[model samples]
Target: MNAQAPHATGRQALFANLLFWGMLLVGGGALAACMLVPAWLDYQAARQAAWAAHARNDALARRITAQQLQIAHHQRDPQYNERFIRQEFRIPTPGVQVVTVEADPTGIVAPADDAERAHRPAEPVFPAKALATARRSPLLAVFVLDQTRPAVMALAGALLTGALCLISGPRRS
Candidate 1:
């Protein structure tokens, strides 16, 4: 008689159950990781982006503040008036001597003439109110916006959804 050892009782059932539980554990772990990792990464990226935006906003604010200070200083100084006049009118400074010497190819020296520069144009005054008005444009409502918050939640939700799909099995048709 051919003899064989009897199969262990309930071994097939045990194996099936073990396999199902193992698959569940592994699948669940993968799903959880897929969800968690991207969320974490997205959160980090969003945080960094927000910080960068905040830095940019702060820099712009500081620049605006500095410009305001400059305007205030100019209002108190008359030299700024002269400078602005020079810029606005393209006028050269009076009483400042500019000497130019011409050299002859034949080794002859030509002396610079002071007579041509003896007479200088008078400087004109500019309206300060225009400059003040230009400086005040920043205080207008059109120049500002509410940048204290930005839209980043959509990015987080999208990442979470993509991760969930990746970890979960495909749906049956």
Candidate 2:
């Protein structure tokens, strides 16, 4: 008599289960990876912003400290006056020659005009923006969600749907 092996159905069920489990594993892993991409991108942006803010704050603090020191110098130093300031800046100082030269293309030094340079207020320097971050790529922006709150939810839903279908699928004899 021609008949199928007694364990044929059992073998088929085992293979089917292995395949379903394998797909679940792979799909879940992929989803987790996808979810981490957004988080990683946000982390990099935050790090850059933090560094910029720290640098700006440090620059401003140093400027304030320098100004305070200057004030203290004027209050404490006995010789701190208009003459002293001018001498410090080498302005109108007798017996001292001031020379400014420009480098010529022919390697010759060309002295600037004989006129004394007038002291003007220094140019204002504004600190760089603290909130500036790297620009996002247009293609990447489409995939990066604002928030990845439910990282595992999608994997879970996919697993459940696949499992239900696999279990309830019609069986052939």
Best by TM-score: 2
Model 1, 1-173: lDDT tens digits are 12322244356546655655665555555445434544454465566566666766676678779999999999999999988998699787787765678776798656645333323332221223223332465432111112211112333344445545444635323
lDDT of 2: 0.60
Model 2 bad stretches (over 4 Å): 1-6, 84-164, 171-173
Local error of candidate 1 at residue 169 (angstroms):
20
**Over 4 Å off in model 1, which ranges?**
1-7, 10-14, 95-173
Query: What is the total number of backbone clashes in candidate 2?
Result: 0
Worst 10 residues of 2 by lDDT: 125-134
lDDT of each: 0.51, 0.60
Please give the lDDT score for candidate 1. 0.51
What TM-score would each prediction reach against the true structure?
0.46, 0.49
* Distance from true location, Cα of 163 in model 1, Å: 21
